[model samples]
Target: MLVRPSLTPQGAALALAQWWELAGLEIPDLSKVRGGNPETGLTASTIVQSQEPNLTPARLVQGSHHPQVALVQAHRLAAACTSMDALYKALDAFEGCRLKANARTTVFADGRQGASIMVIGDVPGREDDEAGKPFLGPAGGLLDKMLGSIGLYRATNCYMTNLVPWRPPGDRSPTAEEIALCRPFVVRHIELAAPKAILMVGGLTGQTLLNSTDGIMKLRSQTLDYRLGLDAQGASTYAQCVFAPTYLLNRPIEKAAAWQDLKRFAQKISAMGIAI
Candidate 1:
């Protein structure tokens, strides 16, 4: 049997510092990053998000590094898109995200554009990347059924897309920098679609959208405001988190809880007088 060695604390810290430098981020105070408790065992990659004003990834994409500069370009392009088609074109043309190079294709939103509800998923999975669409394979089938339960069919009343359009290599979670670069496009998508409600699937989706460190268990089944900007208008939408279909597949026992969340989601939509 091949035995793997674990990284020593010093090695781990060095690696994390290097990553921060490469990403054009300053290494935050390690003690504070660990919440002043080394036993907390939080790696830089796994740090809980803070409630800082700059928590929004879209807000971080400018004048920092090459990646951030690309993010600025993304914002300029995204702001120019007045329609979904234009946004799609922009995504296809954009080359800021490194994931784009290795991905089979750029996965875009699926379903009707003007749908009253939009479902935002985490990064695309392996199957989705191959198909160049969000929510493909078993997970997608499960999502379709889940949506159908609430009379929100993608074919008719719901629009669906992933937060990051391109799939990461090995279907790994997207890095913060990658998400930051892609966020401008996502913001424009939400604006143009103008969904009354947004169903955020997966922990990463909820965390990124709400700018909270809370996990799915804490964030689910509640109607929270997903603010678009901090300006005078304070444009926002009713958003809720639910278990990803992929998660449910791995933990079927949690289906009961997922169902309850779905029911609450449906109730919230109805209370808001959304026909779907």
Candidate 2:
């Protein structure tokens, strides 16, 4: 919600100058602020010279710091990767995750830019590690069928990626430690893509994405909202998480339930008025 305050032209300009200075921005022309403060009948420039408030480091960072400094740095780095190419480069160069050591490739992301639908998988398996793309093996083939049922495909209509970009060793699920280490990259990915909707391909990805411990069977029934907190561009994302296609593949019988989930996701996409 936006609150629009009414102010006089000079008052607005004064406010603008103050805001610019507060934001550490330079304002070359300050004729408006030099005029005078509406509150005190004193010139703003004179006030700055004489009565400028001392800004201490403690005052600057007064509150709202996250508990973990490492995660904060991760968020900062993720915000820096404004473009997909930048994200790929950073993720490839990242040596933070232990999974990166043995992994043959860094599976960053695949599919079209500006894609409305984004699909997220857990981590790369053997073939995916070799190929350096998310969801391109047997699991990916199964995923294609699942999406095709709902009239979606990566080549034309979907954006596919994974939570843990580097393949986990022995085809095992990534540990919580590993997932936490790489989470910022994925969050930035979602913000950059700004996808209208998202699909989680397996339980590991589903749980990690939502920051939950629940299994897919229980989570699948609920309407899950994945909130990617504000990005550097001042844009935040609230995305819907759909059921995992790999689960559908494992238990073909559950595909019926998954189908219902897909239908719901399709309805949501249609309501958004997205083309695909």
Candidate 3:
């Protein structure tokens, strides 16, 4: 397993500046960053200026004192990627998210790229990380069956990707910070794919993308619009939430609810003149 050392506070300040320069953005006051206490004002910037600088963007990404710095870096890197290949390369090279340290491989998206329906899951599991793809193992088989039932096939009409590319250690749930760090890339992915409708599988994915506090049961019953980005170039799409295959595998009784959600999603797709 590869290990990366965490940056000291002074190292973090210097590294952040380098990252900003690399991203071609004017370096802002570090103290004013999201995680920093605004009460301190520009004190963080003052301290950064006083520190001896010696870090490159590549090495700087090993770790950071402020998580928000990493999040900003992720956004910058993801935005710089203009194509899917560029995005994948950027994500593979990105070292901001600590999850990458212990991950076997970077699990990227799979299935059709320009498919009308895009499936977004929470995070990669151990099987996904090992295979370097999303949706694998027995759960993946179930997903295939579920999609088949609705006439949505991953290889043909469906595109698939996970919110987080790297799997958490021991298959643990990803933390909020980890999700935030990877969010930009995922959003950019959706924009590039330009799918008319998105199927958000799993509660975490549904909650995060929809910005809802409701569980999968409540979330699945409603169809909502997901904004692609904050910029003018962004657009909106119809989003449907559904229970994850893995979740259904454990709770077989919930399969009925999952079926209902899939039926509703399919109906909406047809209503939009999208052929499944």
Instruction: For model 2, state the Cα shift of residue 59 in Å.
Output: 30
Best by TM-score: 3
Off by over 4 Å in 3: 1-30, 34-65, 232-234
**RMSD to native, candidate 1:** 11.6
Which of candidates 1 and 3 is the stronger one according to lDDT?
3
Model 1, runs deviating above 4 Å: 1-65
Clashing pairs in 2: none
Clashing pairs in 3: none
Per-prediction CA RMSD (Å): 11.6, 13.2, 8.9
State which candidate has the highest lDDT. 3
Give the clash total for candidate 3.
0
Question: Tens digits of per-residue lDDT for model 1 on 194-247?
Answer: 888889999988876676778999989455876654343656678889999999
Each prediction's whole-model lDDT (CA): 0.74, 0.65, 0.76
lDDT of 3 by residue, 1-276 (tens): 111113333344455555666777666554443245656644333333333143334543554435545655566567667889988988888787889999999988999988989999988887898999999988888999999999988889999999999999988999766877777788778878888899999999877776667898788878687776655445678888899999999999999988988898888889999987
Task: In candidate 1, list every pair of residues with a backbone clash.
Answer: none
Worst 10 contiguous positions by lDDT, candidate 1: 1-10
